[model samples]
Target: MKNTKVYASYRYPSQVISHAVWLYHRFTLSFKDIEELLAARGIIVSYETVRNWCLKFGN
Candidate 1:
């Protein structure tokens, strides 16, 4: 199998990180917006964390 390297050292799972990043890029949403969206879904992540995920995973 091919090795997919994303979320290597992240505390959250790849799915969560991917969703947050996707939302930020796909909708051009702010990091705080993404964080609030996640919180509504019971994820409870900080905007800074979302920003970090974007920097790390975004193109």
Candidate 2:
């Protein structure tokens, strides 16, 4: 099998979430845009949290 990383090996959930948030925000999409997209897949995150995640990580 190919080598694959594991979630347990992840050092920061915030970092990953931040990355996703950045991608979501840098696009022309609205706040609710990414929020609903992720929520449809059961991410259970608020748009406010996503905004914060982007700000914290983007800096």
Candidate 3:
């Protein structure tokens, strides 16, 4: 069986992080833009955190 990695230490769920990363790359949005988008959805995350997610997950 293939092992699925879990985001055990992350404060946010995998869906939130993946969605933020997808928004960053798919829409060519800035980290701050993604931050605001998430904030609008009631998910308060920092721009720096979004930037980090892009760096870590982006190609």
Candidate 4:
């Protein structure tokens, strides 16, 4: 198995974090927009959290 321990400390799953980062970069979407997109998918993440994720992982 791949060492996913890097993501172990986060509250949300790695897939969720990765997808949020992907959406922000791939489409140049705003944090609020990404929040709504995830919300539509039943992921209740805040825009602030999205912003933090982008800053931390959206290299």
Off by over 4 Å in 4: 1-3
Tell me the spans in candidate 3 whose CA falls farther than 4 Å from its real position.
Answer: 1-4
Kindly give the stretch of ten consecutive residues in candidate 1 with the minimal lDDT sum: 1-10
Q: Give me the candidate number with maximum lDDT.
A: 4
> lDDT for every model?
0.86, 0.62, 0.85, 0.90
C-alpha lDDT of residue 28 in model 2: 80
Q: Which structure is stronger by TM-score: 1 or 3?
A: 1
Question: For model 1, how does the per-residue alpha-carbon lDDT over 28-55 read when each residue is reduced to its tens digit?
Answer: 7999999899999989999999998899
Clashes in model 2: which pairs? none
Q: Which regions of candidate 2 are displaced past 4 Å?
A: 1-16
**Tens-digit per-residue lDDT, 1-59, candidate 4:** 15568679989989899889899999978999999999999999999999998888778
RMSD of 4: 1.7
Ranking 2 against 4 by lDDT, winner: 4
lDDT of 2 by residue, 1-59 (tens): 12223324534364457546676757787667778877887676777877766665455
lDDT of 3 by residue, 1-59 (tens): 12215555779888888889899889978889999999999999999999987888678
Tell me the TM-score of each prediction against the true structure. Answer: 0.87, 0.59, 0.85, 0.90
Worst 10 residues of 4 by lDDT: 1-10
TM-score of 1: 0.87
